[model samples]
Target chain A: MAASGEEVRNMQVILKDYVAGFPKESDMNVKTGSIKLKLAEDESSDSAVLVKNLYLSCDPYMRGRMTNSPVDDPDFSPFTPGSPIVGHGVAENLRNSSKFTLLMCPFPYYTGILGMPGMTAYFGFYQVCSPKKGERVYISAASGAVGQLVGQFAKLMGCYVVGSAGSKEKVELLKSKFGFDDAFNYKEEHDLVAALKRYFPEGIDIYFENVGGKMLDAVLLNMRFHGRIAACGMISQYNLQQPEGIQNITTVVFKRIRLEGFIIFDYFDQYPKFLDFVLPYIREGKIVYVEDITEGLERGPSALIGLFSGRNVGKQVVKVTNE
Target chain B: MAASGEEVRNMQVILKDYVAGFPKESDMNVKTGSIKLKLAEDESSDSAVLVKNLYLSCDPYMRGRMTNSPVDDPDFSPFTPGSPIVGHGVAENLRNSSKFTLLMCPFPYYTGILGMPGMTAYFGFYQVCSPKKGERVYISAASGAVGQLVGQFAKLMGCYVVGSAGSKEKVELLKSKFGFDDAFNYKEEHDLVAALKRYFPEGIDIYFENVGGKMLDAVLLNMRFHGRIAACGMISQYNLQQPEGIQNITTVVFKRIRLEGFIIFDYFDQYPKFLDFVLPYIREGKIVYVEDITEGLERGPSALIGLFSGRNVGKQVVKVTNE
Candidate 1:
């Protein structure tokens, strides 16, 4: 740990203003601020832990928070202008100032597989979809943080999994690395409904929805009887001023399909339980995570903005410090 | 019973062709045909029962069957040109022919409170919505067959029930006859979302969706946290070539709402249990059903077509025979 009276430069990516339409790199600015290494005399010792954020997670749902209204989630406050944007990050404990030292021990894994995205995939796939052995699962945005984990988890459960991504590299990674049964570049498909029908001839039983809009509309057309859709996020619709309308939603009635939307905040209590289920897979090399990481905090604005354009191949992470 | 050799004139309604947009009265033609009163020699006594049709039900969902694809439901076959349209009806058994006489004993109640609409309201409200006592419930198409029953059932469950109709008379009937806590003529409301907010300031806990399109979009904005939406039918979209898109569907995620669609065919096994729960309510006049009877089967075409324009006052029924 640094000396008690030492001063440190804290670099952060701050929001310029409330974003409209697609977010541009210029919407964020990297600013330098100073912080004292030592705790104040009056500060509570048992409640707080000093952390040096090492890896900042760049996720699609963060785009929703950039907007002034944060229209999709009423509980989420918008990013304050000229302030450091808050998000999930892998942080290293600098000082033990809390009684719950055990809780702070796992801070390193808080941005990746054992973090918000991991819990999202766990609760979304197992709890929401209720997958059975040999059931067919289809995932959108499958090369991203949550999707990659969902695909691997589904495979571990002995289910057939197919994924759709935006680029050829991501598609190849899904099949070659993640062990997906089939993978497709959704950008190349002229007709998404036809593409989904071609891939899932028997129809999809469980759909892990990440990218919404046209994808959701097509998935609705290809759902099997009593199919379940775990609506984790709608990254495709988040940037649009007026989100696309779903035309074939009536199929929900005929197929007896259940489409439910969820956020990871509600499933935080299941973190310990999720780790128990996933740790073995990670340790045995049965599960793998690919991250698209950029060096230095200066590249944070572009790294975060690149998510909307499908520029990142895997989990986009901004590496702030080596320690 | 009529003599064995007697030939009776059976008035039938036949579709001219698969309808495109709105169905017109001319799309269906009423014609008279003759049927032998007695069963054929090859017809098994245990397999068939002869009955006289008394009342024919005219429902909004039938509009879906008028299309070429009937994309919503594959089980429902489109009306074949020059063939009599088949639907749920009140019938009187003339001959015992079958050993299962007890099952056919209640045929008279098949077109009203004990039939399709009854089970729809029962399962959609009780099973899907899972309403709690003192919760706020809202019903669309309030004066229609299933809607009226749903309103009454919610009231019986000790819920604060409100309903929306298309006309002043229907709105009055919802509040006075059906005992809805409050009623509104939606056609008079300039802004549906504002109107719903005015009625349900605390937000709606259950929304029995009978009409889709703009109403559904508006309802999404007014739903309370963890609200349940029983998508019984989308009457507004049935006749249109393109169904209206719902813009505020992401609210499902923010509010943690569960929107479920159901058809009564899936709940037939629960019919006996439904009867046990509902029969007493009807006996004591705790539940009352209103029928808009159009005399003669010749009026069936006009009565069925009238559903699109909100022409029928209640459960539109064609009184084909008195006895």
Candidate 2:
């Protein structure tokens, strides 16, 4: 294999078959392959992002993609077996469609906050919740990539924001760096509902639903009339064979809550708008981002597994290459 | 009872006690009650409608009010155990607050199609659903008071509307009188989902939800993307100790269906607009309203109980008095 210039090998991790239950690291195997730097000779389409795949995002929804059932599936096209699973990544554009063979100048995993997690925090909060100033906002998984941005955005919008995280360190990050009005470690809290009541005596007006199941049930009972719930992901229920049953959906009727689920791809038109809003905040240091980068593509499997186990501190990403 | 100028005794059906599970005919006992002709002959601040109860509407929502725990219930306010139960009615203003009570006249049963039920059909459809012309609209309980009005409104909006009722007679009324594009007897149809698919090949754009449970599950399956479901009532599940388990709620995420429950009292400002829109239709012969009037206050228990079993056709109403 030639290491430099036009003739370079592309190594990819391919799924051997469809998954059942939580995916294991052994379910996927890395295969060594070569590309001629052009889709005409190697890949299928010129429109594709030809990247030296770096940090692949491991989200709970990926579990749904691994299943083969046609019934009750999300709108996302199902993942094909024995194919390289594609996801949000920070990567180097190794070759251009314009040239027969293009050389790479890489800052691997350098795509800005406009990536999947960023757009998720942006549109999921603003558009789905339609939050107004001074409205009380509550977020779960507060120190993660999406949660951190959501808290910051809520603060920017002049809202009273509270967050619940997994650890004390994450709780502090939420309160200090993210400027959350209040933060709690959900792990330590004995009664989740009482904790919410203590923080918000008046009640929550908007809930960013990152974790579903019992937390959702508690949130439902506590939600004020006309409250909105942006159901971004249900992390707590993703790995289970049977999702946690919710007993309080009737509250949606009584409270007049608008609970809607959304995918970022459905709102791609807002990407430019999202970039405009978040970029300035990033440059001025008004918005701070934390990424837990695990080096090398071979190590991507463990990093992904870390997401489900809550082992990563911030954004869990893998850096494939550096040039 | 002492009479003034035209003061006739007002007869009412008072709730004997709070109901347990499904209410029977013996649950409520009719009682005679009298209101003073002129506000309290001495005091001055009473300007409410002194209606001569003509046709008292029996609705499924009233069952919610009959429970002692209604205050804790989200859908309705609780009924006083020993007081008169309030509902929609078609009545004459027997004693206008500005005028003295006439000795020959008495206020009628304050329940019928024109009272709360009319407003329920009005705002619940137009405002909550925000229906557009030529859209496909589906309404359940089509021959009932609210359903009848909803079907007519959809027809007026140039929509292709279909309605489902329990009996064949109600189905005919939906087609002939209510002007629905099609009507089906859900009790006779083995496959509701298949029936809906046959009726709406393109899928339903708007669903005015009156009867929930299984029909709601079926509607969810056939709803178009971004479809709107105005959840006015879940009549089918009202009497059950626990609401039926739904298997297809996840469809709300895929189809982007907005299923919202609403109360008419929340949008009271639209009352004048409702009258303005409906009155012309009533006079022009474009609209038709059917009422099932049962005579005597003693029969109120049976009339109200009939609503749960789908025994009454058109609007099930009790005729309390003729002044």
Candidate 3:
């Protein structure tokens, strides 16, 4: 069995080792591996479609996959120690007769709003939140990929929406660009629980929990009776050695609150419906999608790690190739 | 206005002050106060109904009511420091023409298994857990009023259920009486997370969270993908000045677990449906109802305080009168 193909240098971001605390750029290595653009007759199979990777999504959830997962589920399993990182990415099928094609993908946008993150915001908010016309909604990590979309969705539903971000710029983006009723810099707040009370005098009806720990505890304190929490992501706890305990958790019973956690994979079957709804929102400028993109695959580690520290303004993406 | 009906001795348990940590028996002052058995001749209102207290339900949620609650909601508002404690009670209508009538009388059982705790277990398990046959279930505080019924419900559903209690007796009762697949004394297990893993090697599909804090943190790690948690109460945290931070809360995201908190007050409308479901089980002896009943209302302080430390064997009830 002779390997016969046109060999090309494929640049890759390989996981150097399993991460412990916060992931640093040093934990990943930029490696150039040779791969055949076209498969030989001997190796060609009906299912094997070799592709050229264009863009990679750098999400906070990737932090979990960086660690050696105990469970063997493919969706949540860890990245191999010395392999090209596996994530939500946009790829161009190298084979001319390829069946694998992303639908109406403008590659970068596909990594954010029009991709997995888009469906996440779609079902996580509408289905999980069960939003009413005049409900109050508070989104943590509001400038990020999912939060921004959720905020916009809440606004479209005539909700009083408030979002919190770590930085001043992201906070501004939430209000000015994403159409949040109001936005606050979480970093500036001394007492987060009290801060939420000030913001929600009547109390929050829906809490889009993105940053967990103190924020979640605070949100628990501020949530109104019969409030709904879509437990989407907990970026704050991802890198921590010890995750924070929720004090006001009992308030859930007192208030009859529903805190539901969901993954986008489970709801992927409904992606077509989400696209039907969101594509129009994007085309008509009803929703704003922002991306903080890094130019090269080599910068993937930094871009992905930046999400933990609130360095990425919106959806973090690594542009592997333009081809 | 002159007080008219025959005045009788109303032995009452009053909160001495707002509690800080674990409540003491001294915090509740047993006072012999005089109360009219009937509405005064001058104060007969069309809506008002006078009743003689028969039995009192001493539940864990009362710990929250002992503290001064910020929210003004009557269902959860704190008891006045010097007033008789407000809680679920079985009362006989002094006026023969009273509309507020108990559908079925047996007062002691009505205070527990047939009343609020019964409804809590019924809806909390059936509605919130979304249980399926042969699914794995775990319940913390499994020998208590609500937990006991929930375990029985799980067994009836043909699910493999494990329960944890603070006492060896309760553990025995869980396995022998309530028909739990397995039971453990959580106090004996130094490592609750490892204990849970040992019991649930495959992982938990449903977690009935009664004692929160460290127990909840452990349950999070043990939850199978798409697990549902009915956050009934956090009796453990109610005594603590600082609630223990849940370290594995991020597992809620990884496992896509749903942690829902509810009160029986919201589900009162569903009581008729619950009665239809559970009354048959109780009558057939398919379910066991345990009660650690105090002889008199004077002993209410000790019995109520006993719940926090897992002192009550089952439903802690104060038999105010046999009348």
Candidate 4:
């Protein structure tokens, strides 16, 4: 560690160029640059805090940042070519007194269960779905970060929970590890609509949508009357230049379905309440969280890209640097 | 009019065949059928009430019934080819003490303003949209039964309302008659998304979706953060075997939008409350309902088909027999 006001070598994962379709590892490069360490005078200092990024979140939403068009939120703006990529990350203030105190859970898990993804699962399921006991629930990308948690939450509510994942292992994880009532490998299913019909003969009452496109179309076709769909993310669609159209959208009207999309940024106020609800679940071993971690900042691009192809088993995170 | 236990000739609109694409007048034929008129001992009697049909409603949803595939609800099941077409109609008990009392509004208006259409507008705008005062609202198929009421409801809440219709006459009606803040002819605009952007420069806060397909795709792009879409009906998509896909649905996630589809049948219990709310509005001239009344039962096919082609100016109703 460099002393205060001393010149030091800093490492960052830089976006080499703007991405068009599926992002490759060549799109980013790990580079070392010089930085001068400085301590801020007060807690609310105007100057930037020199933070040692402990963990970097590899989320699918980051794919929008890699594109040419800027996202609406300035915080999630387009990643400039030849500049550092930005996303949710766990960082400790190295200049002075550290600011973070994640007492309830391990700091590393902040990139997965204890962070934005956690809040997303909590609110998206409870608030948006308005889930009732004994209701049928289905989750797409079932073994992933948000999907797994939602499936568990549905199970907790006495719901008949079914999930779909791309790989056999993820499907098994959803059933055995996450306690989903039934799980299937979406890749193996030739007819998704028929598959859903088989799993949910009564029809799905609530669908936690993650992978949008054909999956969404199938889910729409299988939804029961007065069904609710909580749309959190669409990883499969992120890399596409022109997203595939959802053909069975008319079913939403006929079946009287409610499809609601929510961003975690809007529900940050509920974080404290979410922590109160989920902390006990985590402590009691009721809610189990899985993660796929990659070491070093250099692997950030590949880790994030893995999300599009369903390469990541769970929450994908990169360990930037040790405290 | 027929007396008790009397055999009489009944004029009826019969479905000649199941419809495939857009419904034509040839799909239905006016026929005269024989019926035995009778009266029940009590109001709750199991025997059917022999009544003279006064008015028959011509709604776009009726198109679904004309298809070979039976809709989910048994009440809205597929129309049997070569059988009498069934729909909402204003009738009076001709064989006994007349079971009819519409003191607040005209009995004929029950086919449109004072009944299902009014209730659809009430719940869809207030409950589904959760509209606030001064929010921007947009309505597609704005000159129709439900759309016109939704527009007026938004205006009553002090919202800035814009409407889109298929004709120049309807555009003028939306602005001058229905009191929409701004109105446009969607058929004139080659680029719907750009047209919506022009009208809703600040982005649409509420979208009362009636016409679906590409229009819904355009509305999806122009919605504001935390926008609400009350999907009452999708008139444009019902005729197609394969409904057009909805692209740009991902904006719902980034913008935290809520899109809810509702059936008026689900809100039937709220009729008395709806009457209390809308009756005053009608009496005070705050809410004006327009009707396009066709004179004879034989014209039912043409009147009903006109809804799909946007040939009718307002709520299309066929006066079956004068009360």
Candidate 5:
């Protein structure tokens, strides 16, 4: 068999080494591997698609999988030594097999907005938070994929939406681009509890928790009686050996607060419902989508690692191939 | 105005100093005090009741109130220096005011059961946990005031009930007296999680979390999908500088668990509803009530401190008067 360029091969970024504290650029390396593009014709195996990876989503959860461990981590599984590092990514059908099939979606910009980042925000806000009209909603890490969508959804529901981001640029995007009721740069704010009180003097009813640790503790103090906290992610404490100490756990009982953590996979069955709700917003320009794309599959390692450092402003995506 | 020879002065315990670490017996002291038996008709307060306490219930939460700077505390208010230690106690109405008229009940024991601990278990289980019939229920610190009642109520609801206690005596009491399906001495069990798994191989549906820290972390691993955890008390962590780190918080999302905390004061309106349910159990002897009474007002401080050390088995009560 002659080795051709188009031959079936598994292209992946392997974990060169385990990470401690902050993961550097050199921790990951892109390497080429091989895989069967075709599947067995046995009736037991269903049709599957061999996808050429397009837009890859860079998220905080990826950092958790970078560590080497003897025991399985409760948060996420440890990354294999010599496998393609997998995160949520948009792809096109390179080859169709018995088990899976794929699609070639709209333009490049539309890919990420319709991809993992968009889906995460769409379902996370509606289903997990269960927002209502005239409710007060707060979003932490507001300019990110899930936060940006959550803020917009809250606004669509006729809610008073306030957001907190790490940088002033992201804060401006939250207000100008996303049309949030109010936005603040958490880095600039001396006290988070005071900041929340300034924006929401009446008290916050629903909180989309994106950054856990001290922020969560402060939010607990500011929550109104019977407040709902949809804990989407904890970017701040994901890579730490020990996450931040929670002092305000008692507030859950006293103020009757409900804090719930969620994953988008649970609500994947409701994808059609999500598309039905969000597609119109995208079409009507009601929902503005933003993407920070780092070009090339070789850059996948850095893009994923950059999530913890607040490098990408909006939805962080690595452009694997221009389908 | 002449004092009777047989009349013993109202001697009560006071917070001698602010607690630093685990509260010591010397942190609180008994002080002899006097009060007027009668008040004038034009008294400033009408709703106040002058009651001679017959029985005082020693509770774990009292330890939390002993500190001076409990401003951040979510549950009960902190105790003031030089003041009589106020807690859940059965008292006789020696003098009546409109505010305290609620204490004038036909059966005083009814108030104790229906007042705080009874209501704690009622709302904590039903409202917080939202327990369904036949769901597997596990209670920690069983044979205590709230735990025993929770186990009994769960059993009545046709749920599989298991409880954990520190002593063999309490374990026997939980199984035979309280009608629990199984009970274990946590002190005797080398592995808490393994012990729980042995009793509940199918996994726990509802865990009434009384003792937090390691116990809570263990139960998190054993919880079934969509499990409910009523965070009633983290008695183990109350006195410590820092509570134990729960490494299994990731299970909260994976298992779709609902962890909620609640106080009894919120369920005060349900007192009548609680009595209607519990009175029959008391009369039919379906519910077993145990009281460990320490005689004399001087011993009250010791009784209160004993709760943290697990020195008292059942509802630890101090007998202040013969009546």
Candidate 6:
């Protein structure tokens, strides 16, 4: 029980209060707490896994957890006033110290292609959209974590994929790195519906909805007959006090479209199947992932808040520890 | 060839102009045109079926056809100015005159339980919803054509069914005639979400969405986890220049709900199977239909317009001819 070089500083990001509108870095605080690295005497529970946090994912869905809204899901909960923010992370199992060396992989890989966003991309595209070969696929927030993977997956399926990103650099990354057939800076496009119509002249067969709000409204107007919308996340609407109205929803009826909302947690049962499907592509270098790593948990607040402002070019990861 | 004494006055309801807001009787004109009962010499094409129109269905979907908005469907077309308004009709085949007697059933039966609305109810409930026994089912516009059948079908499935309608008479019809577990007059209730919560304390498992706008918004807030919303029609929004904004749509994500929009025309191939499934119920008096029939084709304009105002109590039908 004596302090014998086992004590380590665990930096934690805590929520200051329930957020309103866009979240600010001031809404969260980074605190340091000491923890013993060794396993406790009563750590015999097989169900319990002690993990040393390495890489933490900053997802758009995290914004929802920061709000006081009563809408609850098994996948996520609202952030408590003075509690440590919890999300998907890549960690080292401290209980099985010897096994940690065997499980070690690139940290960025765990945060991107081998993580929650990767599973989300796999299920949202294949399971929800059911994209057929030669089908047209459009993805919003295309340079972001899930979006980038979805666009690549669509291309792998022999689909003609187009993506919309916020910045020019992200747009270039979507086209050059992610292998998207076409990419555009949505911020530059004043008329989103017209831009969609331009990209998908025959109309979009599958839409991987990530941005939501105006993008969704525009996409609704441009959807093809029997189109499928995989509503994985609505990043643009997450921080808004009042989500924008989708006026062209009647088009769903006319086109006989299917708009399904899903959480990645529901599809975790297929993680192994997804890994088997995706690992070959990753190993062969057919699928590439981009990561924007912000070192240290002290930068967690700014890194997490940066997602709302499109500051992160790719999968935003906060590196808590090298272990 | 000598002219046979087979000429009859073919009374038709013609669209005067593209309707804007709520349809007025003045938007349509009842016109008389003469037609010969005998098929022309060149009408031997196997694809073409000439029939004598009997009962014309005055459905809420027809309101969409009256608008000039260019949202086109293979099932329906916009009403042209100074042209006969075309829609789903119960008719007797003139080409197969000998088989007419065999097909002759109650006109109201064809308009209600054997026509488009019947198929809509069947597919929207069974296919889209996939209601399990003991599930909670909620139907909006509950005493109308599709709603009544959906309620009865849900009852037959051993599910607890609740319905919402515009008037007390319609609410009574839902409970008494259609055997809904509970019925409410939505017009009387100021807060739809609260009313739905009161009726479905555990939340709705299946929602047969007939009315859109506020009702749908309210239903979104009260849906159970993995709830199915069969978007058959949005009668309330058809006539509005600006449909009401659905603010609680994010609830679809939280609840892991499926909202699918479909046209009955797609399910026409399953008609024989549907007839086999439903005819026995009709014969056993397990299923009943209510029709608000307007006598003569001249009253078609009034009957069609009455749908927008919630004036027609049940399935609005214009009885054009008896034989």
- Give RMSD to native, each candidate: 3.0, 4.9, 3.2, 2.3, 5.4, 2.6
Q: What TM-score does chain B of candidate 2 reach?
A: 0.86
lDDT per residue, candidate 1, B101-200, as tens digits? 3343344356767888999999999999999999999999989989999999999899999999999999999989999999999999999999999999
Model 3 C-alpha lDDT per residue in residues A1-323, reported as the tens digit of each score? 22337778878889989999999989999888887766534456755556777889988888888888667468878889988788888876556444345655467888889988889898999998899999999999999989999999999999999999999898889888988999999999989988898889999999999988989988888888889999999988887776676667777777888888888989888878998998887878788889988998888888988888889999999888654
TM-scores for every candidate against the unseen true structure: 0.93, 0.85, 0.93, 0.96, 0.82, 0.95
lDDT per residue (tens digit) for residues A1-323 in model 6:
22223787778889999999889999998888987765444456654566678888888888888887665464577878899998888776665655454234476677777888999999889998988999999999999989999999999889999999989999999988889999999999999989999999889999998878889999998999889998887778888788887777777776888888888888878888988898888878899888999998899999999998999989999998654
Say which candidate scores most in DockQ.
Answer: 4
Q: How many backbone clashes can be found in candidate 3?
A: 2
Model 5, runs deviating above 4 Å: A1-10, A15-27, A32-53, A63-80, A93-123, A130-136, A158-160, A187-204, B1-13, B16-18, B24-34, B37-52, B70-75, B92-108, B188-203, B241-250
Task: Estimate, for each residue in A1-323, the C-alpha lDDT of model 1 and write its tens digit.
Answer: 55456799988888999999999989998888887777554345654456778788887777878887744444477888888888888765566533233343333345767788889999999998999999999999999989999999999899999999999999999999999999999999999999999999999999999988999999999998888888888888888999899887777776778888888888888788998888777768788888788888899889988998899987788889764
Which of the two candidates, 3 or 4, achieves a greater TM-score against the reference?
A: 4
Residue B245 displacement in candidate 4 (angstroms): 1.1
lDDT of each: 0.85, 0.76, 0.86, 0.88, 0.76, 0.85
Error of 5 at B143 (Å): 2.3
How many Å off is the CA of A164 in candidate 6? Answer: 0.2
Candidate 1 scores an fnat of 0.55
Tens-place lDDT digits, model 4, residues B87-155: 997987664565667675676689888877888888999999999999999999989988899999999
Instruction: Give lDDT tens digits, candidate 6, residues B1-323.
Output: 21334777788789989988998989888889897766544555654566778888888888888877676564566778998998877776665656454344576677778888899999989998989999999999888888999999999999999999988888888888888999999988999989999999999999999888889989998999889898998888988888887777777765778889998889889999999998888878889988899988999999988988889988899888755
TM-score of model 6 vs. true structure: 0.95
lDDT of 4 by residue, A91-176 (tens): 88665564567775777688778888888888999999999999999999988888989999999999999999988899889989
Best by TM-score: 4
Q: Candidates sorted by lDDT, descending order?
A: 4, 3, 6, 1, 5, 2
Worst 10 residues of 1 chain B by lDDT: B97-106
Docking quality class, candidate 6: medium
Query: Any runs in candidate 6 off by more than 4 Å, and if so which?
Result: A1-6, A36-50, A71-74, A95-104, B1-6, B36-38, B42-50, B94-99, B102-104
Chain A: TM-score in each candidate? 0.92, 0.87, 0.93, 0.94, 0.87, 0.93
Cα error of candidate 2 at position B46, Å: 10
lDDT of 2 at A283: 67
The RMSD (Cα, Å) of candidate 4 is 2.3
Residue A321 miss distance in model 4 (angstroms): 3.0
